[model samples]
Target: MGYYLMKFFSWVACRFSMEKCNSFGKVLGKLTWIVVPKKRKFMAYDNIIRCLGVDAGEAERIAKASWVQFGPMLMEVLRYPELIKDDYIKKYVTIDGLEYLQEAIDNKQGAVIATSHSDSWELMGAALAQYGVPLVGVAKKQKDSAMDRFINEYRTLVGMHITYTNGVREMFKMIKEGWMIGLITDQDPLWSDGVVLDFFNRKTNCFVGPASIARTQKAPIFHGQIVHRPDGGHHITIYPPIFVDQTKDKKEDIKKATQQIANLLENHIRTHPEDWFWLHDRWKSVREKGLD
Candidate 1:
């Protein structure tokens, strides 16, 4: 069932221009917003109010747009086989911060791309790789094995390597081989070992994997943020490389770096709040544990 759904979506994506495909995504997103459970819908709307302190009306609007945005972005994932070309990405997406990315790559130490669920993140990595940057991003596999394989194959087709969720060993190994690692650092986590950081002025558990790896490997870091323009295109910004403080205590340094990454994420999300994936309860840890 998953396999056929995947094929259907992929075929539909290939049948149209990127803009047209995105229009289809918008329609699907609207349908999903209507059909998905009502409780979950308000949960997201409430989350925006809690995190961003937006009024109920504005939060509701953002939450609705969030649902609509994902459909089109997921289409870009399916269209990877054709969309990962330099001409195509350049045509529809404008990329900045090349010098920062190049600076990270130039450093002998491998670099970690600290990116959040900003815009079409799949397209973010693919667009960079299409321009001759060798990148590898981690993915969470689908429950259906066939669908998982299909998705990863398209990711690789975009010229980025894959490390499945919890592929820590694979991630480090790829870094050792000089591959620039792209880590999605914005998932809500509940691990006791996770670091606590201020997200939108509220305390929550945050992923320390990128910072921990940066300190141990002496790698520089860059925050990748993308925004979908009103003109139906995307603009990607790669902030400058942040080198960790190995000279300080490892634990303290990791916490500081994580906080800095948090700052980057918060800034981007604040600027383009609608572009973020706000449906998930990112503050779940804070709510459940009370800033412990």
Candidate 2:
């Protein structure tokens, strides 16, 4: 049933124009501001307070507005199927740093592209795949296996491949085969796999997967994001590669690489404050432990 629902919505989105879908997104965004639950609202508020050093009232306002942005982000994912063609590329998304990606591909050395949970990230992947880049993404499996399958299908249709987060062996194989890996590096990691890092002026735990993977594979890391312009168009930027020094001290190199990625994410989120998904409990564990 969910599969059919997603497929039907996807078809509807493609049948209409991207502009119409964004118009619907605006209405959905307003509705989400009014309807998100109190508990989730509190979580968002708390996260903002810790990360931004804002008082309760201001945090609440930002959190509410953030939820509004999330509505469009949700719609944007369903809109990915529509963006595979040239018409949609020119109309909605613009690539700013194609040279960097092209250079990496020309070198035949695999690259690690890291992005945060910023505006229409999934759309960024779709656009890259459409542009003829060999892209593969690492994704956590959704609790609902059917929904996961449906999303994987869409990703495949757009020419992006997916490797589950737990498939370390498979990921290594892809990297060895010279496939560029795209990963989201802004989420809080599980306690076992994460290291504490300073983010938004607070010590928060972040996943070390990007650094670990890069160190193991000797890959160059690049930061990229899709920034949503006020006019509803996306500007995708792929920055110059950040190389990890693989010296005798592997652990130190990992820490430095992870910190560099975190710093990049901080700058991106700070620049486009509203476009980020602020509803996540990014500082939850620290707050719960009374450490923030």
Give a tens-digit lDDT track for model 2, residues 205-268. Answer: 8878878888899988888988877688888998888888889998788888888889988888
After TM-score superposition, what is the CA distance of residue 180 in candidate 1 from its true location, in Å?
1.0
RMSD of each: 1.8, 2.0
Per-model TM values vs. the true structure? 0.94, 0.92
TM-score of 1: 0.94
Worst 10 residues of 1 by lDDT: 101-110
Query: Where is model 2 more than 4 Å wrong at Cα?
Result: 53-58, 288-290
Model 1 residue 39 distance off true place after TM-score fit, in angstroms: 2.5
After superposing candidate 1 on the true structure, give the runs of residues whose Cα lies further than 4 Å from its correct spot: none
Once model 1 is optimally superposed onto the true structure by TM-score, how far is the C-alpha of residue 107 displaced, in angstroms? Answer: 4.3
